[model samples]
Target chain A: MTNVLVLFGAVIFPFVVGYILISRVPQLLHTPLMSGANAISGITIIGAMLIAGREGGNFGYLLGMIAVVFATINVVGGFLVTDRMLQMFKKKGNKNPQE
Target chain B: MEISLSAIGFAHLLAAGLFVLGLRFLSSPTTARRGNMLAAIAMLIAIVATFLDRQIVDFTSILLAIAIGTIIGAFSARLVKMTSMPQMVAIFNGFGGGASALVALAEFQRLSVQAQLPLPVTVTTLLSVLIGAVTFSGSMVAFGKLQGLMHGAPITSRLQKWLNIFLLLVVLVLMFLIIGSAPSHALFVILTVVALIFGVALVIPVGGADMPVVISLLNSFSGLAACATGFVVGNNILMFAGALVGAAGLILTQIMCKAMNRSLARIFIPRQAIQAEKALHDASGGVSESSAAKSDNKPQIDPLAAAVQTLSAAKSVIFVPGYGMALAQAQFKVVELANLLEKKGATVNFAVHPIAGRMPGHMHVLLAEAEVDYDKLREMDSINPEFKNTDAVIVVGACDVINPSATEVENTPISGMPILAARDAKSIIVCNYDDKPGYSGVENPIYQDAKTICLWGDAKDTISQLITSFSG
Candidate 1:
């Protein structure tokens, strides 16, 4: 049953990712599109998550921990980076005082 | 250790849902920010789940690593300027490629050392290595050029095209034999390096004029590589996502090519006589445009007087802005002007061309930032009809895109490209700092039109004066 669950995860995860990439990505950007995508791809922590939860060797668990930290950095780091870039545009947006 | 696919699957699904919605929202400048936010949210969810799921042996090291990366990423992002966003994007893209490449190469080393890799594994592994290496190097060259660390002109010389063909042959031969039977890892490494150089050569020669399109095309290549990597790893999510990106990027590349009136092959053509011929034509025609300015006879109207007339003269006005508009930081004032015009019972519309400004829908984003109504912003196809009904088309700080040269000039970079035909309007008033032609160095004859008028100055100041001229 757990194997079935794992298989289901593998099948469904791709569909979800596909939905995001196909129907959603093309709407607003192209130039800076890859940066956002790259930032998102740092989600390898999920792989680490599986490795971590599994009853693995001590070294395997250590490897999983390292991977999770890297993944977390990517996520939080990506958002902060994006916000910072957005700020520069905001500052230069327009000359209107009301705005 | 046993991996539970079900829990991870549900998490991936939710994350992917967010990713899709984020992408959809990004399509319109109106929703671009929201889309970015949604995507960010999805990333957050993905990261958090992955983090929590990991087995915690010693939490201190994990927390420290997270802390260090967060500080660095946040700091770097904050420090980067909007003007340099393109370069930053390239760098980030290179990182993804490099990471994937390193992963594939390391895995190959791991498997090779074990002295036995199945046929399927070997093939998938090599494909991943090849794609990743190419993407990594190509993206770095792109970043270097965009960052001004390298030249923007196409770096071409005689027989460079033939050289590329030879390189491709070597790369293919190397790929075929190595995958069939494992070779010395050192030889394979060298082969990968050579292919990486070829990737750099392929992109470095492309001119800055075609940058937006090149960026899209290279992006598609990267996505395709990612898909191959996913196959190697048996990661369905990576494959699906990569396919989506590849398809979208390819479509964008096509649209960009069409917009420039250039073929895909033209982008890769090296040291060809066709380009030389085009340059010759441009230089010959340029001499006449500078000399043709009608001297001293025509009456130049003051902006205030023009504004008063503009307010009273027409029922409908279409404002067409370009890269100049963005540079001027005048969108807010333009918004104000639009509002005033609307209040005075004049219908106002924004005409946006597909390839206008520096990127696709460039002016649209600037205007949306000014809080302009989304409905009022119209694409080229939709607004052409409105131009017929329009009494005035006030073109602001724009060039190239609106230049009649596209329709009239032959062999020019933008020849045969569609434009707004703003010159056809009953009254066309262009507010710009320069009477010169745009990007391709070709001259625009629109300034010579009988009804055409040029109000020259810095765009923001001129538009600000127009706002004052209108309010008073």
Candidate 2:
């Protein structure tokens, strides 16, 4: 139980601190912040695979399976999304059209 | 009991730490890539640690599930195009929300089958399940709209608002039924379906411009539902991370909403449903037809030599970027030009508008990706005072947001819209394609200003040229 508490510590501490810092900054950086944070969500899939495999109750395994699937799609598709979004500019050769 | 649950917990801790570093890096577009890579490494290590755990006796299902998902994930990543990225994000996010909802629902079923459910546990689980399902479905609908599988800005009338209000009322009723009496299987499914429909109803009427905020808000709801589920399951780490995501996502959503000068409640109001009614009463007026047509002409520039002379003599330079920069993908070249100018020790700070790009803080991320120093980026209010102090202001790929005329033009569609006043700067250089209208389709009178020089071209090409001219 204490170990669980400590495990809780790792996840909770950073989130709290991060939430505070980001909240204080100007709101304008939110999109970039979100895009950057999305990469970590991809990492979450990797985490899901390990925990789900180890905690193999039939129920846990199934739930884990779904989590792994969704998180993976999030990660890979997310990166692709970010990359594609960046490509919109290179697709067109212009300085700043429409002043 | 769970194979040194403490040690593995530490590993998760380390992974979460990596997530923090990654998130921190994400805060600035400049360090976003490094942040992403670091988080990926952390995630890989987390997988290895989890794999090493002795909790699971059988690995067969694990291997199969991973293999299938990996293949599917990899293929989708390869196939999704840049234009479709927003829709992909919406779809993937919906899945994340849906998975959490499913987990909660399954847990409830298991408890129900045993005929042994704790009172508090059942309530939280039901709450999570319904919210999660709704978020997932709603996100999918949003994706459809953004992808143009549905129309971009399908403005209906006041019925949209009434429906949204009615849905909220229904959600409250469902909550009461779930909490007061243990819901039967049919009721549970109905509750889930209604919530999902409510999610769709919530997003259906919003204009295309509001997608960024809508996406962020749905992300928050998904996180909140996950946190609620974590609580029901007695998983502390899951609860913590879920809460973190929920809170941060909500805050981000609020900021995004504010950037658009909108309130979260207003997003629910569905004014578009009343569009026809308002049109009949108000004679169907908003955008001026004449001004929209005025933006089509090719922009003319002042002499290059004279413009260069003006900039060379200026003491301070603040470059204001809008969606145009993102559309142009000119952050790298913009940074290069800034660096070139900074070599001469001209104080160059990026004046970022709150709603400058397609999303909130869009330009910051783009600039950060180019490795611009963090200190150089200033928000609208921060840079506003300095615009008076600055010698030259460069308006890049910006639209009416920079137009000085909008501040006073009450009759104009964008009248009273706050913008960076390049017209206010001593010598202003407007670097955009031409007089072509922006996304909102309005003309900028700032272009016709005596001091404003319009540098007409695509931003990337033009900035590169500007850099070359400087380098030579």
Write down the lDDT of every candidate, Cα atoms only.
Answer: 0.62, 0.64
Which stretches of model 2 miss by more than 4 angstroms?
A1-18, A25-29, A39-64, A75-99, B6-58, B71-91, B144-150, B268-318, B328-349, B367-377, B389-394, B403-418, B427-472
Residue pairs in collision within model 1: A6-B5, A20-B20, A24-B23, A24-B24, A25-B23, A27-B26, A27-B27, A28-B26, A28-B27
Q: Could you give candidate 1's per-residue lDDT for residues A1-99 as a string of tens digits?
A: 964664455434444444444443331244435445545554433343443444534554554455445444545555555544332233224425562
What is the DockQ for all candidates, taken in turn? 0.21, 0.25
lDDT of 1 by residue, B1-472 (tens): 2354566556667876776676666554446567668878876665455544434344455566567656766666667655455555555555445544544554465456655567766776677567767766887888788767899767877667888888889888887777667545875687779868877977787765566666666666655555555555555544544555565566666777776677887887633546745753674464443423553434555544765585567788889887677667677778888888887899998887766654444564567556676667777777786676687888887777787777776766667888886776777777787876665666667666656666777778877777777777
Off by over 4 Å in 1: A1-99, B1-5, B13-18, B21-38, B48-69, B76-84, B270-287, B296-314, B327-345, B465-472
Error of 2 at B137 (Å): 3.1
Candidate number of the best lDDT: 2
